[model samples]
Target: MEQPAASGPPNVAVRAAEKRGYAVSKEQPERPGRPTLDAGRSGGVTVVGDPPRRPHARQRISTTLDLIRANPTGRIALKIFIAIAGALVVTIGIALIPLPGPGWLLVIAGLGIWAVEFHWARRLLGFTRRHVHGWTQWVTRQSLPVRLVLGAVGLVFVATVVWLSLKYSLGIDVVAEVMHYLATH
Candidate 1:
């Protein structure tokens, strides 16, 4: 009798093996207790995550310069107006320093407006950045009782000024006379 063919068609062999409850095995064993890989991580290579990004100081300065350069005449004129208006507001705010309306905020805004165009203003801004946080921290470190007392005093001062302004602007002279007396005597 002729011996069975040692080599047969691959599909036939596969079918025969499957009929016998046998199956082809992969090269490596699948590991347990690990996250499954998806299409983005199909390859065997491991990828490190990227570091966080931060804007550099020079980049900020260059962007500011680019903004200034973009508009030749219009921006310059606008900056001039901002400087003038900011100065006027700051001057009036300073006059009201002993009264109310956030004098320091107006001054800071004035400097900020100038800072858009001037190097000196930029330096001042940098100076304020360095110290303002520390100053605020110091103010907060004061005793709670002291803070309450100071806050009450500031509120009273603000209320007095608002009352005087409303009274005088409405052509009422009594509050103005009282202020004049307080200033002189």
Candidate 2:
């Protein structure tokens, strides 16, 4: 004689169990309706299934930090580590921002790094996301000619910034060089 399994969706059961904080058990019940050993948040209710499946990557990383924070010394160390790493990323992003080549990408990445550990950064990231999304939506909705004009304006802006940066920061006068080349030819 053998006991039959409980009848319900396994995924739902697992999710409910995990949300209420119980380790999942794959084994079939010794007796139907009998609770697992680590079954309940309190005597008021029971979670009769397994824990959540592997968490998302973000959750996994957060759990690692949670584990580290169990110790007071480890908590301090983690904060210091996050601060230094985030600052380094932001600094590099700032340095590269004037010259292009994934400069904005790096700066956003740096902001993301800081957002993980700081509330201010998290809010700022949200604001940035919203504004960028709005801009993209606005651009996509415009007429072809309007969009083309906008693109031309953007190109001109980039060219001006690049020319100025090279000339002023590196002493490389691109317009003069181009003129000299044209004259020689």
Which residues of candidate 2, in runs, are more than 4 Å off?
1-53
lDDT top scorer: 2
Instruction: Residues 60-114, candidate 1: write the lDDT tens digits.
Output: 4544444444455645776788678868877876766655568778777778777
- Residue 79's lDDT within candidate 1 is 72
lDDT of 2 at 26: 43
Name the runs in model 1 displaced over 4 angstroms: 1-64, 70-107, 123-134, 172-185
| Cand. 1 Cα-lDDT | 0.62
Instruction: Output the TM-score of candidate 1.
Output: 0.43
The lDDT for every candidate, in the order shown, is 0.62, 0.72
TM-score result, candidate 2: 0.70
The clash tally of candidate 1 reads 0
> What TM-score do all the candidates reach, one by one?
0.43, 0.70
Q: What clash count goes with each model?
A: 0, 2
